[model samples]
Target: MRVQLFSDIASGAYAQKLLEIGEGLLGTDQDGMIPFTQQFCHAVESEDELIEKVFPNMQQNIVDENWLCERTILAPKNETITKIYKKILAEINTETSVYNSIDTVMSSDDTTNYPVEFLNSLELSGVPSHKLELKVGEPVLLMRNLDAPRLCNGTRLRVTELGRHIVKATILTGEAKGDNVIIPRIPIIPNNLPFNFKRLQFPLKVAFSMTINKSQGQTLKVAGIHLGTPCFSHGSNHSAKECRTPVRCSICKRTHHSLLHPKDANSSEENKTECVVNSSEAGKKQQQVLLATALVKTICRNGNEYSIRALLDQGSQASFVTESTVQYLGLKKTGFTSQIAGLGGN
Candidate 1:
C-alpha cells in the first residue's frame, strides 16, 4: 500500500505528524523490517519519518499515562552516583557563589572603599520597608558612589538598614578631592558568598530578551516574547498598497518582555516554565521551496533587527532562515551572524 501525505494545516499539525508515524508502523512486513530506500529531499523537510522510527514507545506513550511511570529523583542511601551528583552541584555552587573584588581594604572599623566609578544607583526600585527582605538582590559591594560599577554586572547586593552611611568615597573627578559621601537606606552584606566573603560578595538575577528566530532549534517550556501590537501584520491587507509588515494582535502584544522566551516544551512542570509573546511579524516569511516556522527559542535580537527562522529539524542538529525571504522583508542585518548547519546558504 502506498501513502501520499500532504502537510496538513491544523491546530495540532505537529502532534498529527507524530500520529502519522504511529499509523505507518502498521505496514511492517512479516520480518518487521522497513525497506532500505532513501529519497533526495528539499531544504525544509520534517523528520517525522525518522522521529516515528526512533520512538517505538511513542505508540505506548501516546495513550497510556501510567506507562510514563517515572523514576524517583531521590538520592539512594549512599549510592556513589548520588555523591557524584551532589559533588558536582556543590562545585557549581562554589564557582557561581565565588564573586571577586577589584580591591580589598581591611580597616579597623570593618569598612571597604571603592572608586567613584565603582558606584551606581542602588535601585531596588523602592522595595517597601516591610517587605525589604523579600527582595532578591544581595548588596555585595559598598560602593563609594551612587552609580553601579560597570564591572559589577552580575553582582547581587542588599544594603544594611543603617551602616551603609559613614562609608565615605569620592564621587567626583579632576584635581578636586571631592568630599561626596555615599548614603544608603541600609548597610550591605553578600549572602551567596562563602563564609570567607559571605559578608561581601553578592549574586543578583538579571533579565534578558531573545528573538524567536534564534530559539528555533531549541525546546523551551515557556518563553517571553515582545510582539508589539503594531506588528508587520498590522493594517488592512485589502489596501493592496504593494507590501505590508505584519502586526501582532492585542493578545500577543501585551505579554511582558520577561515572558517571551519559553524554557521548555510540553513538560509537566508548569510553574517553572518560560513564556513566549509575539514580537512584530518581523520573523515570518513565505518560501515556495522551503516551508519553515521560526524556532521560537533560537531567535535572537541584537539591536534594531532580530533573527527568526524555522529549525529545519524535528529536534535535529540546527536552525535555519532563508536568505531570499530575509531580503524580501527589508530587515537590517546584524553585524554578528552565524551559520545554521542545515540551512543551504553560501
Candidate 2:
C-alpha cells in the first residue's frame, strides 16, 4: 500500500503542482524549498527537520496569530518531527474558486468556450500566447491573477481517485507539448454499461485522436501521430497528423523493410547498384521512401471513370502490378473490345 501511494505521488501532473506550491510557499528566487523538500522527502536522519519546515509554511498561511498562541496550531519550522500533522494540514487546504462569474470555479462539470478571463490578464510579458494552457473547470485557488510566471500552463483540476476525474489528452501534431485536460471521472457512457458500479474510480489513459473541428483552429509546429492504422482511432480522419508506423520501402510498397534492402526488390540489377550505395545516398533513399509512403499518391485517371477490361492474370502469382500489364488489359479484345485511351494517351 505504501509503494502504491508513493507511485501515485510520483505519477502525472500532481507532483508538478506540489512542487510549485512548495516553491511558492518558501520563496521565489532560490529554488524555493526544493532542497529542503527533497531532503525532508528522502529523510536520512528522520523527517523531524523537514516536517518542521514544510508544515510551518502552511500553518502560517491559515492559522491566525491567536491559534498559534492557544497552541491549537504549532508553528512549523525546519525542525519538527510529526509528519502526520503536516499531511493533514496539507490535505485540508481550501479549494480555489473564481470570485466574479468572469472567472469562477466550475459549478457544473464539463465546460466549453468558457472565456479565460483570468488567463488573459496574466503577467505574460515574455511568454508566447500559444504556451498558455488554461482549463476553465480546473480547480485552482486563483493565485492572485498571474502575479508571477506560472510553471504550469494549465489550471489544476483536482480529480479524486474516488471522487474527481483525471482526463488524459495526448499532444496532437500542433498542440504544445505536455498540454492536457482533466474531466470528472463521473462516467457518461451509454446506459448499456453499468454506471453505479462504484464511485470515484478514474478512467485509465485512453489513447485517442484529437477532434477535427479543434484541429481546424491551430497551426501545429510538430505532429505527434503519422499514419495510424487508417481507422483505428476515433478521430483518425479528423486528425491533422498521421499515426506512427514501421518504416517501409517506397518502390516495393513493402512495410517490412524501409531502405529497399536491395535484396528484397525482386529485381537483381537494382539490388547490385544499391548494394554499394554510399551512406549519403542511403540517407537520401530513406528520406524519399518515408516521404513517398507518407504522402498520398496521386494517380491521374484517363478521365475514363472506373473503366475495366478483361485481365488474364494466368498463374496464381506470377508477376507484379505494372503499368504495362494494366495497359495490355485495357487494350485486350475480350469478345467485346473498345478503344480506350490510357492514362497518358499511350
Candidate 3:
C-alpha cells in the first residue's frame, strides 16, 4: 500500500548494510575495527579524483540547477569545506561578487566594546559570515528559515543574478523547485552569542561543499565525503560502539577506553602509603581517602553565617550537607530517603 519509494532496490540494500555496520552486527578484526571492503568503500583516493567524479563537467554544468541539486561534497570541518568551495569556484569562469556585511552592536554606546572588526572575524554556527562571496550559477544553501514551503532553511538554490540589495536564485528542491526567488539582506542575530549584535547580509553560504552535520535530511544522487580530519562525534557516519579497534587506558595501563578509567586510580604508591596512619586511641591504622572539596559561607534562617566544607561529587543526584553543620546553623531539614547504589552494586 506504499504510494512511493525514495530509493531503489540497490540503494535500499546498500543503506541496510550501512545500518548493520553502524549497529556492530558485522564482524570485526582482532583490534575491534571493521575491515575496509571494496563493497563498502565508495571512496576516491585523492581530492581531485573526488571533485572530478562528483562533478564531471564543471564548467558546462556549473549553471545547471538540476545537476547541482543532485550532487554535494561533505567535509568534517568548515575549513575543508571552504577549500573545496574555492576549488570548485575556480573551475567556473565567472566574476565573483563580494558582499560585505554591515555589522553593529545592538547598543549604540557599546560599539567600542564590540568593534566591527571583532564581529567580522567571528564565524558562529547557523550564521553567515561577514564577507559573503558568490558568483552567478554557483549553488548556495539558505542559512535562515525565510519562507517555509518555498525558501525554508536548508533549501538549496542556484544563483541566477546578483545585486547590491538582493540576490535572485532558483529553488532546486521541494514543491517550489525551479521557482525563482529574491534573497535580500536580512539582520541575523546569533542566539548562541553572549552579547547582542546584528549582521546585515545575505543568508547564504556556498554549497559546493558543506559540513557533514548540515547535510542531514538531504538526499543526494552523488556525494563526496572529505575525511581530512577524523570525525570527533558519533553523529558523523560512525560511533564509538561501532569501532573495531582496541584502545588502551593511559592511567591504569589497562586494555580499555581511557574515559572509562577511574579518576583516583592514578595515585602514586607514596600517596597511598600517606593515606594510612595509626590512630593514637584505638592503636589501629585507618585509611583516609581524598575527595574534591570546596569551602563556602552558608547563611541560615536567622541571618547567621557559617563556613562549611562541601564535597564536590559530580556523580551525585542531589546535594548533601553534614547533620552537625545543619543543626548548628539552625537550618530546616527535609526528610526524604532514597536508595543509592555505588560501584559493584554497593
Candidate 4:
C-alpha cells in the first residue's frame, strides 16, 4: 500500500534532499563523519539577514493568513525565538494587546517561600509565559491540548479577535484548518519542577517564530532556522549537525564547532586522541547514567559556609560525601566499614 498523497507533498528535489539528510543517509562523508553538506544548505551572517532571507516582502503579506501559515522560523532556544517574534511583530502595524498571568503557589504555607514574582519569572518548557503579547491577525501556537483533532498542542492558529479573558483564533494547520476556535485563560501546572505552582494564562505562544523542537511534524512551505546558539540536546544535535558551514571557536581559534571547544584545550585534545585510538576496541555502546544534583551550602567545623555540588539519591538509605569535599569543609569523620552494593548488585 504505497501512499502517493503524503509522498507527493515532498515531491521537490530540494525537499527530498533535506528529508534524506534528516534520515542520516545523504549528507555525510565516506567515514560517516565530518564536513557534512547538501545542495540546499544556505548560510546567513546576521540575525537580520536571516530573517530577511526567510520572510521576504514581510510588510506586504504580514496579515495574509495563507502566507503566514506556510512559513515559520525555528530557533534552538525560546529566548532567541522570542527575539525573532518581536522583530517580526514590530514591523506589522497593528494594536498589540498585553495579557498578564496570575501566578500562585499550590500550598499556602509555601506562598511566602515562593513569591508571585518568582513564580511568574519561571519560563519552563511547554508552559506559557507570565506575560503574553498579541496582535490581531498574527499567528499563535496552542500550548495545551484543548480539543483533540482540532485544538491540540503544536496547532498553529491566526488571531482573529483578542479580548481580556479569551481569544478567538482561526486554525491554520491540520484537519481543522479555517476553523475558528475560542481559547480561554486556563490554569496550567508544569510537572518538571521541584515545587508546585499554578499559572492562569492563555495556553498560547506567539508563533511567528518557535523552538526547533516544536517545529517537528510540521510541513511548511518556507522555513528559516536560527542557529545563534548551538544545539545541545540529542534530538536537536542530530537535526542541526548536517550543516557543512565551518564555525570558528572564539576561545581556541580552531576550525571546529563552538560547543566542541573545551575549557582545557590541551587536556581535551589528548583525551580526544586517546578516544580515537581506542575507537575500534570499544565496539559496545556505553550506558548513560543520569544523576540528580543540586548546589547547596555546607557549614564547616569553623562555621564557614561553602557552596558545593551534591548528588541527590532518593532511593539510597544512606548518604555519602566525597573525600575532597569533606577535606575542603574541614569536617571530622568517623570511619566505618560496611558492605556496599555496587553496580549490578555486586
Q: What TM-score would candidate 3 get against the native?
A: 0.64
In candidate 1 the C-alpha lDDT for residue 236 amounts to 35
What lDDT tens digits, residue by residue, belong to model 3 across residues 1-346? Answer: 0011123455445645654564567888998667766676676789988899999899998867778999999887888888888888889898999999999899888888999899999888778888888999999999876776577667899999998899999999777898999999999887667789999999999998888778754668888888877766556555546555565445554443333222233467543322244344465544333344556898888998878888754223345667898788897877888764432233
lDDT of 2: 0.27
Ordered by lDDT, highest first, the candidates read 3, 4, 1, 2
- Where in model 4 is the C-alpha error above 4 Å? 1-39, 233-346
TM-score of 1: 0.16
Clash pairs for candidate 4? none
Candidate 3 residues lying further than 4 Å off, grouped into runs, are 1-7, 27-35, 233-346
Worst-scoring 10-residue span by lDDT in model 3: 1-10
Task: Please say which candidate is ahead in lDDT: 1 or 3.
Answer: 3
lDDT of 2 by residue, 1-346 (tens): 0001112323323333343342243344564223435423333343334334333443343233222211111222211212233343344444422221122223233233333553334322111221212222212211111111221212122212222223333222222323343332332121222221111222221111122211222232222221112323454332112424554455544333323232323446644323232353345432111111123232333444332333231111122345664573464324554443211122
**TM-score (all chains, Cα) for each model:** 0.16, 0.16, 0.64, 0.61
lDDT of 1 by residue, 304-342 (tens): 444455434222323234777556455466766654322
Each prediction's Cα RMSD?
23.3, 24.5, 18.4, 15.1
lDDT for each of the candidates? 0.27, 0.27, 0.75, 0.74
Better of 1 and 4 by lDDT: 4
